[model samples]
Structures are given as C-alpha cells and as structure tokens.
Target: MRTVARVIAELLVTFGLVLALLVAHLKWGTDDYTRRAQRGLSDELDKVWSAQSVVAVKPGRAHAVTPPAPAPAKGRPFAVLRVPRFGASWHFTAVEGVTDADLAKGPGHYPGTAQPGQVGNAVFSGHRTTYLAPFNRMGELVPGDEILVDTATLTHVYRVTGHRIVLPTDLSVLAPVPGRPGERARRASLTLTTCHPKYSAAYRLVVFAELSASRPRTT
Candidate 1:
C-alpha cells in the first residue's frame, strides 16, 4: 500500500511540472512572436512608403494614385491597422505565396481576394491560439472602431458594422466576387474570421466592416 501511494504522488508531481512548463512556454513564446511581428511589420511598412507616390489634389490635400504600373504585389495592400476597442495594431504583412512560418507571425490574407480599397471584399485570416494571437479578441469589435489598411497607394479606414457566427461550411460568407443568388451584395468591405466558441474550430466568428475613408501617407 505504501509503495502504491508513493507512486501516485510522484505521478501527480510530474503532471504539475509539465503543466507549469507549458504555461511558461506559451507566455514566453507569445511575447517573442509579438516582438518579431512588430519588427517585420515596421520594415514592410517602410518599404511600402518608400515605393509609393502621391498625386496632388489641392492645397494641403493629396490623393494616392496607382503608379503607372502596380507596386509588384510582393508585400501587402495595407501598411498598418489600428483597432482601439481590442487594443490591436500592427503593420499588415503579406502572407500570400509565403510559408506557414511567415503567416504565423502576423495576419495573412486569403489569396485572390480584393486588396484594400479595391472595390471588393478583402478577406484576412489569423490564428486564434498560439504565437501571438492578434485576432483573439476579434469578437469584441464594436461598430465605428477604426480598422485601417495601408497600401502602397493609400491608407484606408474601415468602420466595423456587424458580426456573425456561422458554421465551418459557410464558405459563401467570403464571396469576394459578390452577386450571390440569395444574399444581398455587400459593398466594399472587410471580413475577419476565426474559430468560434473559443478553443475550438467547430464554428467561425466573423466580423464585417465597411470602407469609411482613405488618405495618402505622407512620407
């Protein structure tokens, strides 16, 4: 009896140690990823600004115009985002045609969607758990909170209008081409989605926001 009780206590101690290690790893890993993401975002933003040009509109006003040719789709549409309600802000990084390692560092886009301010829906994705979950609090977005997308040409701001909870099979919710048979065609918008119900992927949490305004970035 004594031997059996001692073995059980040892097992419990081992489990506790493992749990502590996991907690520490998650905390430290999140911080490290956050710093790495910030640096990458900043560098990308600088590159975008340097490559873009603005067209003069009026006194103290200028509008971004597409360069005679596109900016080489190598980076991303937006430069930075400001989400005050959720306390989330970061420069947009292009994960298109990049590895999962690149995507894990920051928000990534679903290829083939409209880039920011392109007169169509732009869909972006990020993880709900692990490696600095930037969209973890995405469900808390309120109407009128700013969602900025900075491209080489312009910086666009979006005002979150609504959100929805849908099943995993609801791919129609992401139609960038628009003109669905039954659903109303939403205007130029942004949709953010993640695994719903917390800690699970059974459903999706989606937030929708509409383009509010756009301005040129003054370098």
Candidate 2:
C-alpha cells in the first residue's frame, strides 16, 4: 500500500509540471506563427493601392468611442486602413480591447476614444505578437501611409505623421490632438496602439495619423 501511494504522488507531480509548461507555451510559444500571419497581411496591404473601403460614422449609442456598427448586410463591419509607403493595410472591426478573445475575431477598437472621421482622436488597439497580431509590425509603419477608414456610408483618408512610445500611465496620447482641446474640430486623426518593448508591455506603442481626404459612398 505504501509503494502504491508513493507512485500516485509521483504521478501527480509529473502532471503538475506538464500543466505549467502548457500554460507557458500558450502565453509565448504561438508568437512566431502569429508574427508570420501579421507580416503576411502587411505585405498584402502594400500591394493593394486602390480599393474602395467605406467608413460610416454616426453617434454611438454606447458611450464608447467608435463603437462598431453592424455591416449593412449583418456581416462584420470592416474598414480598410492604408499606409502607402509603409506597405500596411488591414481590416479592423471596431470592437473594444486587445485581449486574446477580442483579437481572435478582429482588431479591438479602443473604447472612449474617438471614432474615425469624428471630431476627436480615434484610437485602435491590437496585439503586437500573438492572437492574430494585426499590429505586430506596427513599428515598421512610416509617415505618409494613406490611412483609409471605411464604413457603409463613406470613406475617410488620413496620413501618418509620427509615433511615440508612452508609459501606460501616460494616456494623454488618447486626448484629442494630444495637447489641444479647445480648438474647433477641423480634422480627424487615427491613433494605433499596442504593447511596447517589442515582446512586453513596459510601454505603449502609439501611432498618430491625420485626416487628408474623404469620399462619400455612392451605394
């Protein structure tokens, strides 16, 4: 009986070690595949130059900024964002947060931030290296990407200006225009966000882009 008890104890210990390893792998091992998928999407966006992605803007019933409205046909509402020189483009759904669950379906839109083509700052969030990392190559994006926000009603275009890495505590990057608040709303901007420090969240990656043009939907 004592020998059987000892064997059971050893088996339990082995199971515990295996469980721990599985958890760690889930947290980090999938990054390589995720990065490849992300880079592939960026490459495809670089090739496409003239696709009509439409973005429609309306008062959000929810208090969150840029809350996603349903697509006209009940499918996912996708918007095309173009950055020409950077060779970056992706279809993002305006859901909130960048969690694993949120990213599995699409890029999560930062809540309480302005929607694209709105009077304030529109912030979008995505994972950098896992869970279908749409923004993994975010650091590669350069100035002059034609950021196109498309909805069911219209398409809005913006140009990348610059980027900054700020502490998570420093959320001023989400503020309208990053410093000016009293000026009359004249333009729209896109702020893309992700975890900074490459593989960690020691800081926040922020990409700032400004509106350049707009096209109304004909349909």
Candidate 3:
C-alpha cells in the first residue's frame, strides 16, 4: 500500500508539470507568433507605400502622381492601427477580414463597413486574451484618447468618444452610425470590438471614436 501511494503521488506531480508546460507554451507561443506577423506586415506596408509614390512628368514638367492601390483582399493587411493611450509602441496591423484565421495574425477590419477615413464607421475586432491579446487593454481606453489609422495615402486620427459592453448578437453596433440602426451616418467614426471581461467571450467590449483629423502622408 505504501508503494502504491508513492506511485500515485508521482503520477500527479508529472501531470501537474505537463499542464504547466502546456499553459506556458500556449501563452508565450501565441505572443511570439503575433509579434512575428506584425513585423512582416509592417515590412509589407513599407513596400506598398513605396510603390504608391510613382510619378509621371509631362513634357512641360507637370507631374502626376499615381493613386494608391485599392484595399487589400480579405485576410490581408491594409492598415496599421495605433492608440496613443495604449503606449508609444502600441500598434497593430489591421487585416481586411475578421475571420478566425485572419485574427490569429492580429486585429482585423470588419467587412462591409466604412474604410478608415470614410463617411461612415470603420469597425475592427481583435482577441482579448489570445493572439497576444492585441486588444487586451482596450477597456482602458477613455473618452478623448487618440486613435490613429495609417494607410498608404493618409493618416486618419480619431478621438475616443465612449465605450460600452454589449451582447455578442448586437449587430447594431456595427452600423454605419454605430448603435443606431437604420440611421444615416453624418460623420466618420471608428469602432473597436473585443471579447469582454478578459478570458471570456460572454460579451463584447466596444470602443467608439470619431474622426478628428486627416492628413496626407508625406513620402
């Protein structure tokens, strides 16, 4: 009986160690992968923006600049999101779609909504507890904080207006005039959504902001 008891104790200890390792791997592995993806996306954006600087000079010397490329395809990155309140290094590449696979790379832009700097709301979503928890501190955002979206052509600056928690089924929050279904949008806005309360998807935490300024990006 003494030997049997000793064996059981050893087994339990082994199980505990294995569990700890698994948890650590999941937490650290996801963070590492997200950082790698962010770097790659940043590099890609540099190339994209560089390509947008093509210039054609007429015989008389009138130069015409080529327009920026269209938005990237679904699941591809199109912009970089930055919130000053999140810290100096707080930024993420926002992909075009919010699919599970796309989000694993970083925050994702919701389909069918206004693109950044457009007349309507531009919506984005990110994980709260996984995939580096890109929006882990989203709840910390408060009114008047600055949120910036940088595209190849322009930098759209938005100021946080408010935040709220809502059920996952609340599609109204994705409207052209967020939280107001069937209403005409009079202003450009930004909405960021993430799983609420940390480590749980029981609700969605949304941060709303309005475009405060937009400026052309100097090469």
Q: In terms of lDDT, which candidate is strongest?
A: 3
lDDT of 2 by residue, 20-71 (tens): 9976675566655554444554444333222333345568743213344542
**What TM-score would every model get versus the actual structure?**
0.77, 0.61, 0.90
- Residue 2 local lDDT, model 1: 100
| Root-mean-square deviation of every model | 4.3, 10.3, 2.1
Q: Which residue ranges in model 2 land beyond 4 Å of their true spot? A: 1-90, 96-100, 179-185, 217-219
Q: What residue runs in model 3 are displaced by over 4 Å at the alpha carbon?
A: 1-8, 58-64
**Shift in Å, residue 106, candidate 3:** 0.8
What's the lDDT for candidate 1? 0.68
| 127-205 per-residue lDDT for model 3 (tens digits) | 9987898999998888999999998878999999999999999999999999899999999999999998897899999
